[model samples]
Target: MRRREGENREATNLNVNSLETLVTHIQVLSGNIADLTYLSNVLKQSGDWLQSEQTRLAPLLGELNPSMHSLGYLYILEAHISAPISKEQANELLLSVARFINACTAEQIHLAPEKFISVCRRFKDQVLLLDEPLRGVAPMLTALRKLQTSCEQLTALHPEFLLLCLLSKSYKTGLSILEDDIFDFDQPHDLFLYCYYGGMICIGHKRFRKALELLHNVVTAPRLIINIAAEAYKKYILVSLIHLGQFSTSFPPYTSGAARKYLKNFSQPYLALVESYDTGKISELETCVQTNKDKFESDKNLGLVKQVVSSMYKRNIQRLTRTYLTLSLQDIANRAKLNTAKEAEMHVLQMIQEGQIYATINQKDGMVRFLEDPEQYKTSEMINCIDSSIQRMMMLSKKLTTMDEMMSYDPSYIREAEKARSIFDFDDVDSLPLKPDIDAHLKDVSSSYDIDD
Candidate 1:
């Protein structure tokens, strides 16, 4: 019994020594950045020590020295970012860092804006590189907000903070930053990251056009990174189907041949599904998606692909509107490949509300009456087109007039025109055949010909 008690005392002493060593390292790192290599090593040691000692120290450490714990976490983050850590190690380090950041008071975070920003930026980079969602993103965003409140000027220094905002589902904050043009990406990867996250945010807000535009930027970047481009293409295709009912004709023209080919090869399942959708082969589309279900899930795109499938029935139903003056819900179910009449009715109601199809439903007979009068609709559309054309032409005229004013004031342009006129004059002089006699001879010939006539 005495020996066991002695062992417990020894373990307690070891824990105390470990805690003291970690505190010392954290203090040294906080005071200096001259030896980042040594600091990195010490911080890593501190992290390992903290992990082993966490259960025993959790209750007392918060009250005894919270600032020390926070600084120690900052050191661990700095070290993790500087060193080459595995994905698992990075994740674990980030989890600890996040917890520490969250535990700190807003005032504590505000007081250390630089350190907070440093940690947030590094954490954002890791999250982006791993291409996985982090659980602790909310705390990171909260800490960033506090840092921003403390030093608004420093916000611009870390544009990747917007990424953390988005990841934390802080869409309003991210959108504000995006609108303000505060994000400045210096690297190709960073640009892709911004577009990818921005597109997702747009998707969440149901801004499909803006989402497509952002994803298009990612897929069509000059230095195309395959994984990001592939993911962007998947989202682009899904969003395109949702927004335009088909891929826009203008989309392919912007993409390079290599990108197109790569997309075809890498995204064959999606391409097949799109073709089946366009051709109105509902069964084929369903089968293709089902067969590639694992692939879709692995790519994290199963939900989007399923959405495409849901939309296929709508497209088919819309096609029926063109051919039939009226379709009963049963007829729509049969023609649109829907499972039941109720499903067809729901789709038709939604389409009517969205202005995709003009129709009124009869609740009694379950009949759908098409309200579209082709001739009147055509005439109104034609008038709208004419009005739009006139507006565009007026804008074009203004633009041309402004351009002419600028050209008129350009000395180089005026000098070039004078030079061109002189050249033409010299050519005419050279072509005069060195004789007025040539002109007189031609006149005499013309007069003789007139007399002969």
Candidate 2:
């Protein structure tokens, strides 16, 4: 009996020791997988090797123990390859892999919720590559709910995540979540999320100015929970400018930051205006300008916005122009009426300074208006040239003809000419007439400097 009991105790100790050994091996594997992540980071450095290694590891992930996190680590490493993995294949593998992680996470929750959280977070990191299925927004709403629950359970402080959830919810509903008064703005972290979410919601609702203000606050927030917040802020500002109907400015919608990756895609909607406005192509401008006119007519400050749009486009608005005002500055000011003469003047001056408008100051009235017409200006110059040339022609004809007549009949002039002819060789032939080469000498002298051809 004693020997049997001792053997049983020894066997239990042996199993625990073996489990420790397994954990150690899993940790080493995790380190190796981390090195693989660096390869993914330097994609251009070892792309071929990384791809082959990724392919080799895909099948091995299924056999790893979830508690060890080897499987989760491998899945994430594969996800970072930057090449398109088959979505269907990724979906199948990730769903099963995520489920395994979830089960292991649930088991570990009581023992250490932080570990479970870490495991669950890895699924999110990898699965972001998956395209969200197009549905009636139910899946996104549900996902937001799940994320909220997870955030609560895991004690995560990711402001951008929370903001995205609120934004997705608001976009899906077409209504403000803040209207229900569920938001707690006193909490800095929650406030950060609320502002970002509210801003995005405003964008969807086409309240671009409001959205800009909200995004600005979130952008300057001291504790940014995500690296992309600054970029998101810039995009929001640009989009707001577009929403406000400013399209002539050179400020594009997406430039640097997180938007740099998606700029190519985000740029498509504004391409027509970009080409038209940038190249000064009148036909394209007409089409795009018309589109913006129609869009802003539905806005609350339609009258004021319409005038500004017309002035910039030199006709009625048609399509929305992503001009700088609409895309960058207008959103910050909301859709407030820029109707006052003073305000309009300031706006026009700003446009002029931006080289979008050309204006001249009327010193008499202290007013600025569009620069003078080119054709009309040329005509005025031509009129002045013709007037000056007519006066000069009259003076030249009177002086030269009067001088010629005087010399033709002068007795002293005839006697001197006769004497010179006698000395030159016989008073033969009439004294050579002194006719001036007038036309040739006067060819370049003009009485008028007119622009008319």
Candidate 3:
């Protein structure tokens, strides 16, 4: 009886998995056929039939067990709704999908290729074979393989990579089915992959028009795999379009507030700075941000802007670090005394601009100095003091290490080691220097301090 129960459980699990797979495959197939209808005159008659397939699959999905994978599947369906879907709804769907995938992983559920293919074949029987999927068989298989590979490990926090791959295939496949040869209908999914890959490749080749055509179809995918893909691809497409000087056409989808602001981040600063005189582009950037005011004001959008700013700041710091690493310790120490190396360097720059500090490079000695300010001199002095302290600490650590080795090997040396270890002095030459006004940048450096109870 127990053995029979185990077999029954396995069968039930398989049934659920098969159902989910079929529903997803049918959904994609229907989406492809609908897309092909718009592309060519021949497939126009199959438009209603494609919609019916989606309607049919939706119910089948509804019948599946309410597990995380099922929920994730439903979220994908939600993402397929008609144009002008609300961001809140779209985001909710994405989040749900993410959570569901995570839950499935947590439950130790794993999906494999064989199971997926079996489900795909079943779906093809009812959906594709019934009315001839616009994209032919080979293209569809290739596209599904790409999608399956890309969609692996869906539990990852950023599923956008997988989503992009899937949607790209969907878009490409649909376009292929619209091709002249009816029997040559490239599998909608594989065609989608070709378009996506081709677009990116075209961009690299500087074929802006070809890239735009491929990407535009992706943007217009009715059964969009993920809202994030639309927003992401749209930005790239607009960038390419703008590069080609198709400004009006390259603008943006006016409805999706998030995508608009994101695109602006790329073009806005340049528009504001270099094109300051170009009132039209400036107006365009301003209009986009203002139109999305509510989205801009929302915490989510604010967080995104904050992330961009943070990334830029970190990049600047890295650039400075690389620059500083090349300067000699003496140069660093000299710079540090004035205002800490970073500030002193900036101050020197300011003085040069103000004509207060001029470079005095002696040709005979090959020595350089600045006609420095008193404040600059103090900053440089402090920097040197800090550098000396650091050197002293390094020397002390080396001596300590030597002393430790001696004590570890010699009994008599233990006493000296104990004494050395017991000697605690705030004025120890090796002590890290405390800035007079370190409180000003307390938040920046305080975390580096090690405190022991």
Candidate 4:
């Protein structure tokens, strides 16, 4: 029994030694993976061999402790592989990659911005291709934001990288950059692309008005790029339908006539849909959608078109409030082309709840009453407008005050102002004769005359 116990102890030691060896191997592999310069050199030497090397190293990373630096490098290497990788193979790795990026120090990102940005761009493309809801988008965006904060030069070099990162639910980051005019792009396409992404981000956050403004910028760029303008025009039409219940005829006056003509041709389906909606005829709109179903689907605009269709009843119902103080549910149903009085009542109720209409419902009488008391209807809105104006003024005042303080304390500005004042005084001296020292000048003249005598 003692002999057997000794043998078991020897087996345990052997296992311990094996574990240590495995850990050593993991450390070596992780270090090698984290070396971006080394990986870049490998790719430069032989791109084909990089893939197999990455494949071999990837499984070993799984065996070791998960780390941000190692995961980030691995993701970059994987993206460099020439062959298309399956989403299933990439999904788990991508989650780790996102976490690693999010946790990276500003210094680390600054040290290796090219590698960091490459990972971000590749991850964005992969997520888009997967056609899945972005799961770790926020963290990835945070990582990109950190990189931008640390090294603005990266953004100047690859504005699209930061722009794509902002497209992934990073509206606050995107908006801050836009408001500050932080990006400097050498190419016009970059500016258009920035506006395009900014508009989409606004749409995601339900800031429809802001979205329209950004899209308008893209559509009306001075040197209009047709593809960007066409795309922007599509969004502009949909957002207009949602915001105004019809298409807008007023486009930017500065837009070229030729560009306007091309947009009209490109946006025919949307124009038809808008016209159908404007007629206040649900059947016409439905028929129009059905007829252009193939076109809408081909343009990938069916979803937006359907939203416009759904809003048709609301517009029709709203019209009735303007004409009638009170209307029976059945009348509303008939007028709005809804199937039943019950459906009409529900639509009205929803509109009322949303403050779209100043109206109340009478369940017993099955009637809807429009609130016609101007005071009651308009007072709250007036107050809200006043409050909003005050808030805006206060914000403006604060900004101006801050500017004044900055200017007042600027040493260089003060020095320049003093220099300008001295120059102005000298100019005044030059313009007007100065009074001479009279006594000294008279003595000098008398002495000169006495010497001559």
Candidate 5:
């Protein structure tokens, strides 16, 4: 009886733990692309055992090439992330992972996304450890393209790739990704990194309005942590002063409680300068800047602070545009507090060249004449701008309508809305759960991009 029971147990163990069985099962399961997600769940459920089976790692990875068995290869790679490796082995692993990421079947990998992002993150860590961020840039960009169903989709890759770009000073390439309006994100931290890094890229380009919008996203996003928000608020104040020519003393209503209370404590110098800006006196702004010059230098915002000081002169000159039709260069300099008539002429010429103001400066007489904005709203460029604006609005409206329809089908969403309806004076739209789908719909729109491609 004991021998019979032992034989039965051995048979059961072979049935479940046999490598041949798993290999055959993976091959058959991978044959049908549609079953990839089920395979992913199976791997996810077995992740701990897989992680423990480091002895079988070689044979398993050898049998599962990424091109033929992308899901299996990815799972093994994910498992290997936690396993120990020497520096030399890690360098080789980096190359192998990059190859797997580049050559793996995207549709298969996307279905078994359980560890694809984590694996990508490991690749980034290896790259950073090697101190070759530039080498990481192209691979990360490829990983992002492979993992996303749309270029606009935000993932953990967004922040990592942006950091690589920032380190490599590939600002133009980074800006390319930022052109897409990212409404879909896997995590709030991803969104924060996207906005914060994206804002810095925009600042590099001197796209101040776009920078302000991105930085504002980080500042106002509802988060328990305040470190990133505090840094963003510092930039936000400087960008507001530079781009808008002034900062608003009124606080934004939607800012989270943590941000409202703590961000101010770290950014007192910036806020004081805003007060100086409000006084509409360059001398006070100058004094504030000089007093806090070391702080600004430590913050690496000295350049922007100088621009703010210079912008005050421009703003003061622009105000003169409203009140005076004409003024001699010396008079303009005195009013705007410039050092000389030549300096006043230079500012006017730059402002006019930039379409910030309409004016003509006569070098002969040193007189400046301010005129109404000369834009006629009739140029081909203006018409194209208007058409593009209208098209973007229409596109956004359609997306909102589609999302609303999607939410209406979610049972949890319906229950939440019903609860809201049961409450009195519930006018806030903030109660609804933000997007419901984690691995959202795939390449549904013909206009949409495919992960497989």
Candidate 6:
């Protein structure tokens, strides 16, 4: 008992009386304290003690292999950031923490979640403060990937990581995270930010369909104010115009009343652009864009608005395909409102190259021959794609069945259902309709109808 108490006391004594002794002291602690839970609890409980020793403790954390002493390093790092530090020192710690984060053992880090969260939030700030925030992208992503228990579990880090990716123009890295279906999350705000930033990432990828879907989620998701959703709604309008070539004036029935009322007022310019785009007149679209040029530029959506114009051109050209089997480039130029035959030919060649239209352009004759789609869906790749889609649908069906079963087994749902059934159930004496000589009446009716009695 005395020996064990001695060991416990020694573990608690985090004194670095001298710079020379700091490394030796940490080594002793790591070696003597065999139980990680004990070490984790000690570090957690003594955060104040650790904070006082921050000057001595900070250096030791960098010296220790984070994988070997994750709990101690996490707690110390959390303590180190709890107080303020100079910008110069923060830059230094940013590099240090990034290194630690990459090397930290995942299993041990989970032991002190509170400390881990603190360090992560601080790290995000440190990286964002750099002159070139893009430098933070790779490390932030690595940290997020490491810290999360599962890809499905959304954390506070999710929004910051996405912001870094956006700042760095790392859309593919952002999509790698966004592609995961988040089924578990503790904060509503985190979910909102995830959808918002994730939608922007998809837009960067020119994935208009996916971008619209994600932005729509932000708009319709239940909220009291929905400022983020309102911002997402503006982007939603632009994407909807580009992708669907039309926009609905009304919000869906499920959208919060606050969104429907205020969103339109805030984004009136974008809404007007929608109106002009619906005209299918390139001149009107261009005019609306020029009129709202300042607002779109301020919102950093000037580029996206330009894509809407190009999409309109493509849409106009595609319409011509339905009408004429073959048309000279000059006729296409006239009908599509393009300036010249060369411009029309450029559009045709690009569309054909993208497989957006099945057409052959005769360069010598300055004519385009639109043809029927050639895909017969007989290739092995097509078969595999179709089979995969069916499998996914089957999986979704099974998931829905499982969720329904789980809901049926919920205590609250079961209780409410029982209450409803009991309240609606009728008693024989009180509620049953009185039928005097019902059997005789039935027999008489049957005889009257010439049925066998």
Number of the predicted model whose lDDT against the real structure is largest: 5
Per-model TM-score, in order, reads 0.52, 0.30, 0.21, 0.59, 0.78, 0.82
Q: Please state the error at residue 183 of candidate 4 in Å.
A: 7.0
* Ordered list by TM-score, greatest first: 6, 5, 4, 1, 2, 3
Q: Return the lDDT, model 3, position 54.
A: 49
How do the residues 1-453 of candidate 4 rate in per-residue lDDT, one tens digit apiece? 978955753453344323234334334433543443433333233434435455454544445443434433443344443346787866765675676665555543454566666666566556655643245455554654676653222252233433443434455555554543333344555566667666766655557788888888877775565655676688788778876787776566777555666777888887888888888888999999999988776665566677677678888888887899999999999999999999998889888886778888889999889986345536888889989889977977887788789979999979977996787531111111121222232222222211100
Could you give candidate 3's per-residue lDDT for residues 1-453 as a string of tens digits? 978955753453344334355444333323243322222221223234333444344455444342433323433333233223344444433333333333322111222223223333333222222333232243333324333423321111111122232223333433332222111222344344344444543443434566677666544433232332333353343434234322342444432333333434534432332232133233443454445545433312332222222222223332334444244323533533332455444544543564444544343543335342446535777999989889977976886788677659997667765775688311112111122222222221112211111
Give candidate 5 regions above 4 Å deviation: 1-29, 34-42, 53-65, 84-90, 323-333, 340-349, 358-372, 401-453
Q: Provide the lowest-lDDT 10-residue window in model 1.
A: 444-453
lDDT head-to-head 5 vs 6, winner: 5
Cα-based lDDT for every prediction = 0.61, 0.42, 0.36, 0.61, 0.76, 0.73
Model 2, range 1-453, lDDT digits (tens) per residue? 978955753453344323233233344433454432432233223334435555455444445565555333433344443345565655664565445544342222223333333434443433443633122133323323333433222123233233333323434453334333232232565565556656655655556666776676655554444433533443443454455444432323432233333333434434444455444344565576477654333222233333333443432111222332222223212222334445444565555575554565454565544553244435777989888889977976886788789988999979977986788532122111121221221111111100110
TM-score of model 4 vs. true structure? 0.59
Worst 10 residues of 5 by lDDT: 442-451
lDDT of 1 by residue, 1-453 (tens): 978955753453344355555555445444444433344445444555554554454333343344544545554344445555677777765675576666654544444446666666656556655655345456555665555543212252233554554445555655654443322233445555567667766765657788888888877765565655676787788788877778743345656545665655677777767777777788988888888888776666666777678778888887887888877899999988888999889989998886778899998998998777434535777999989889977976886788789989899989977996787532111123222332432232222211100
Better of 1 and 6 by TM-score: 6
Better of 3 and 5 by lDDT: 5
Off by over 4 Å in 2: 1-14, 17-89, 97-113, 133-170, 173-198, 205-217, 223-453
For candidate 6, write residues 1-453 as lDDT tens digits.
Answer: 979976765655554344345444444455433556555655555666667876666666656667777766777677777777777777887887788788887777777766777787777666655545576777777777777898768876787777766666678888988877676777766677678778888888777788888888878775523445556787899789877878898988877666666678879899899889989999999999999999877665777788788878889999988899999999999988999999888888888987789999888988789999999999999999999999988977887788789989999989977885889632111111122322332232222221110
Off by over 4 Å in 6: 1-34, 400-453
Highest-TM-score candidate = 6
Error of 3 at 312 (Å): 17
Q: Tell me how far the alpha carbon of residue 238 in candidate 6 is from the true structure, in angstroms, after superposition.
A: 0.8
